[model samples]
Target chain A: MKKLYGVPGGEVLELDYPAVADYLVQFLRRELAWRGFEKGLVAVSGGVDSATTLALAARALGPENVRALALPHAESSPESLADARLAAEAFGVPFEVIDITEMVEGYARLRPDMTPHRKGNVKARARMIVLFDLSVAYHALPLGTGNKTERLFGYFTWHGDDAPPINPLGDLYKTQVWGLAGELGVPEKIVQKPPTADLIPGQTDEEDLGLSYARADVILEHYLKGYPDRYVEGLGFSPAEIRRVKELVNKTHYKRHLPTVAVLSSTAINEFYLRPLDFRIELE
Target chain B: MVRHAIVQLAPEKGQIRRNLARLEAALAELAEDRPQVVVLPEAFPTGYFLQGGVRELALTAGELEEALTALYRRVWEGPLDLVIGFYEKDEREGAYYNAAAYFELGGRGLVHLHRKVFLPTYGVFDEERYLSRGGTVAAFDTRFGRAAILICEDFWHSITSTIAALDGAEVIYVPSASPARGFFGPRPANVERWRELAKSVAAEHGLYVVLASLVGSEAGKGMSGGSLVASPEGRLLAEAPVFEEAALVLDLDLDRLPPVRYDNPMLADLKSGLPLLLNDLKRVVEAL
Candidate 1:
C-alpha cells in the first residue's frame, strides 16, 4: 500500500481559510479600488476553482457589484451550467448565460478538420473575448479562475482562461482550492465533482492528466519548493509519474512567463525601465 | 512534566480593558485543562504597531503591578504561571520599553521583567523612536524551571537565545505580534520561517522553546498566529491554527530533554572562547 498525498496517513497541506479569505478579500478590494475599479467580473464554470473565485469576488466587491457569466457550448455539461447558476444565485450576484456554440463554430468553420484540442482552444479564446467585452462594458476587472496545478501543467488555454488581470486562485493548488471552496460555502456537489476544463465532451482533468490531484499536489509542492525529483519520488510517488509531471512543468515553462525580448541596450526593459513595487523616490 | 498553554489572540487596538477581558475568557476556557503556564503574544495587552501612541498605551510599573494583582486574583485558582508581553513605562526614568513580564499565581505577583534588548526600526517597525533600549539579557528562576522571555524581534537575533541559554535558562518563551506575509503556496512563508527559527533555537540550546504569536488583522495588517511548541531536540510537538484565535495546551516532558549540550558541546565551545573574544574586542576598541 502506497501513501497518497493529503490522505489520512500522508502529509496534509492545509490553508488557514479564515485568514486566507480575509487577506484575499481585503487584497482584492484594496488593489482593485486602488486601480480605480469598483466592480469585478468572474467567469463561473460551475467548477470549484471558478466558483471559489466568484465567491471571493462577491465578498470583496459586494455581491451587488460582482457579476458572473456562464458561457456554455454544445459539448458543455448541463450540470456545470446548473452549478454555475446555483453559485451566482447563492452569492446574490446577477449572471447571464451566453451560448457560445455558434460563436465557436464560426471559428471551427474556418478549419473544418481541426482537432478537438484546437477546437477547445478556440472555444476558450472565444469565452475570453466575451468576458473581456463584458468587463469593458460593465467597467469591471476580469478575475482569473485558473489554479496553480493547471497553470503548472499548462492545462489551460493561453491568453484565454489565463489572461485575467487579477487572479485570486493562482497561488492555490487544486486540492487547496477544494478546501477553500468548502470554506467559502460552495455547493457540496460542485466541491466534490470531478474537475474539468469543459473544453470537450467527457473530458475530466484527472483522467487527462493521468494522476489524482491529491497525489500530484504533493509532488508539485515539493518540486516548487526546490525539492529534487528523487526526494519527491522518495515520498512514495512512482518515478514515471514524477518524470511526467516534471516534463509537463518544464515544457510549459514558456507559458508561465512573458515572451522574452532581445536586449540591445545597456539596460534591458524589464530589468531597469520598470520601477519595482517597493522602489521609493523619497525617503521618509 | 509541565502542561503549557499558548494563547494566540488578536488584541483590540488601544483597548486594554477589552484585550484583558478576552485574555480572561481564554484563561477560563483553559481552566479545565489546568495548564501550569500560559503564554500570550507580544504586546498582548496593547496592540502592535502603535506608532506615536506607545506612551499612551504603555503601562507604568505601578499600573502594571496593580493590574496583574487584580488579574491573578480573578483568574487563577492554584499554582499557575503566566508570561505576557506589553508596552512598559519606567516612571523613574520616564522612558518606554517593549517588555515581557512573568507572573506566578499567588506569589510575589510580578516576578520578572525582560525588556526587549533589540528595537527593530526598519520596514514596518519604528520602535526606536518610541522605545528606550534595555542594556542587559538575563534569565530568571520560574515555576517552570529556569525561563526567559524575548519579545518579537529580540528572538530573531540568535545571540539572544544563546545569552539566555548561557544564563542557565531551561526554556525560552518568544511572544510575537508578527504580521502575516508572503504567499508561496498554501501557507504563509513568514509562519514557516518562524517555525524554523523556533526549531533552531531549541536544537541549539537543548531546551524547550514556546512561541505564542498574535492572530487577526489590526489596521489592515494581518498577524499570522500559528503558535507552536518545540522540544529540546527541535521537534515540533504541537501547533495552533494560523490567522485565527486558538488556545493550544500541550504536556511537555521537561525531564526527557536530550543531552544535546553534552553531546554537541556548542554551548561549551562558546563559553570557552568567550574570554579571548572579549579581550580581542577590548583590544580592537583601544586601538581604534
Candidate 2:
C-alpha cells in the first residue's frame, strides 16, 4: 500500500541519478585500474540488478571489454533469457547464454528428494563456477549484481551470488537499482518485470519476502537510521512485516562476511590487519 | 588587491613522493600568475583514510619543507606564502598528528602548524583511531594580516573559528578532504553543505573564509573538489568544480572586513561574554 518511489517522510531515497552515474562510472574505472584490470565480467539474469551492473561496466570500461552472459537453468523462463540478451544488446555489449541445467542435475541425482530450494542453490552455485572460470579465462574481474536491500535482507544465496570480487550495485538498494536501471537505458521489458530468482514457475521476489521492494526499502532505511519499531509502525508498516525484515537481516548476518577467523596473532587477516591500500608503497 | 588561490588536489593514497611532486608542479606554475597566497586541500601528501598507515607515511615538518624547497628553488620565488596540509610525525615526542602548516616561502619559513582538534570517529570517518588530537587554535601574523589555518574536522566546531577571530585573525583557511556522500540533486549534498558552512562562518565572524577541498577516488570513496572563497559578507566569490582537480583564484579587498564587522558586530558582542563562557567551559571540563 505504500508509494512506489519515496519514503513516507520525504524524498529520502531520491538520488541525483546523473551525478551518481558519474560517480559510479568513475568508481568502477578507478577501482579496476587500481587492481590492474582493464575489463569487467557480469552474469546477467533478466533482473534489474545485473542489467544495471552490466550497463555500468560497459559504460565504464567500454562495451568491447565488458562480457555479459546469461547462465540459466532448464526451469528458467524463456522470457528471462530473452530479457537478459535484450539488456546486453541495449548497451552494445556482447552476450552469451550458458545452460546450467546439466551441471545442477548432477547434484540432484545424489539426493533424489532434494527440495526445490536445494536445487536452486546448486544452480546458483553452478552459475558462480561458470562465471569465475570464465573470468579467469578472459582475464576480466567478475562484477557482483546484488543490491543493498537484498544484501541487508539476506535474500541472496551465500557464496554463490555474493562471490564476485567487485560490486557496483552492492551499496544501492533494490528500489534505487530500479531507478538506476531506468537511467542506464535498460530495456523497459526488463526493468518493469517482476523481480524473481527464476527457480520456480510464477515465483516473484515479493511473494517470498512478503513485502514489496518499495515498502521494504523505506522500512530498512528508517531501521538503519536507528528508528524504533514504534516509529516505523507509525509510517504505515505493520508489526509483522517489520519483524520479518529484522529477523532476516539478523539471522543471515553470517552470509555477508568472510569466514570468521579465530584471533591467534597480532595481525589476523581481517581482524587486526589493515587494508592493503593503507600500506601500499609511497613512491607511486 | 591581495590575490590568493586554492588548489583542489587529488592526492593519491600512500604516495607522498608523487603527491609532493604534483604540489611542486602546481606551485611552480602558480608563481607565474603571482598570487601572494596559495592554499591546498588537506592531506596533500597522503590520503585522508590512512588508519594504521599514518605512522609509516608521516613526515617531519623540516623534511616536507626540504622536499618542497628543493623542487621550488629552481622554478620561481617571490612574496608567496603556501598553506598546505600533511600527516605530521614528531620523532622526539613519538607522536603523530593530522596537521596543517602555513609556510612563508618568500620570507620566514614554517610560520604555524595547526594540528586537528576534532578527529571524527563516526559515520565513514575514522580519524580519531589513527591521529593524535591537537590542542591549540591560534592565529599567526602574515604579510597580509593575522591569519589562521584549520584542518577538516576542526572547522566543524564553531569554537575553532571563535578562537581564531578573538585572536585578531582576519582570514581563516579551511583545508578539508571530505568524502562525497548523500546525493539528492544535480550535485552531491556535500556541495551544498560545504557552501552553507563557509558562508555561515564568513558572515558570523566578519572574516574571509577560503575552503580548499580534495578530489579523487580512493577505493571508491570519492572526495568532491568544490574548493571556494567567500567574502566577509558571506558571498561566494568563486568555487572550483566538484570531483575534478582544479584551482580557484580571487582578489580580495581587505577594506571590506571592517565594514562587515561594524555592521554586524557579533564578535563585538561576544567580547563581553568571554568571562562567562570561560567559567561555564571550565565547569564542564572539570566535570568531564
The candidate that wins on TM-score is 2
Task: Report the lDDT tens digits of candidate 1 across residue range B1-288.
Answer: 889999998776677877788888888788889998999988888777776567667897557667766766687787778888899999889999998888886775777888988999976677897899987788999865798888888889998998999898888999998887665455687889899999989988788899999875554466889899988888899898877789889987767654666776666787888777998868987999
Name model 2 segments beyond 4 Å from true. Answer: A1-11, A106-114, A200-202, A276-279, B273-288
Residue pairs whose backbone atoms clash in candidate 2:
none
RMSD of each: 11.3, 3.8
How well does chain B match by TM-score in each candidate?
0.93, 0.95
The most accurate candidate by DockQ is 2
Residues A204-246 of candidate 2: C-alpha lDDT, one tens digit per residue: 9999999999999989998888999998998899999899889
| DockQ per model, Cα | 0.03, 0.55
For residues A1-284, could you state the per-residue lDDT of candidate 1 as single tens digits?
A: 99777734444467777667877796677557645799999989999998999899999989999999999998898988999999998888899999999999977889879898999999899999999999999999999999999999999998899998778888788998998888899888889999989898989999999899998889998887778888887789999899878888999988987788888886676543542221222113
Candidate-wise lDDT, in order: 0.84, 0.87
User: In candidate 2, what are the lDDT values of residues B1-288, reduced to their tens digit?
Assistant: 678989998877888888888887887778767888889888888877777888888999989877766766766666568888899998998999999989877578889999999988998888877788999999999888999999887888888998999998899999998888888887788788889988998898899999999988876688988999988888999999888899887887787888889999988888877877898899998999
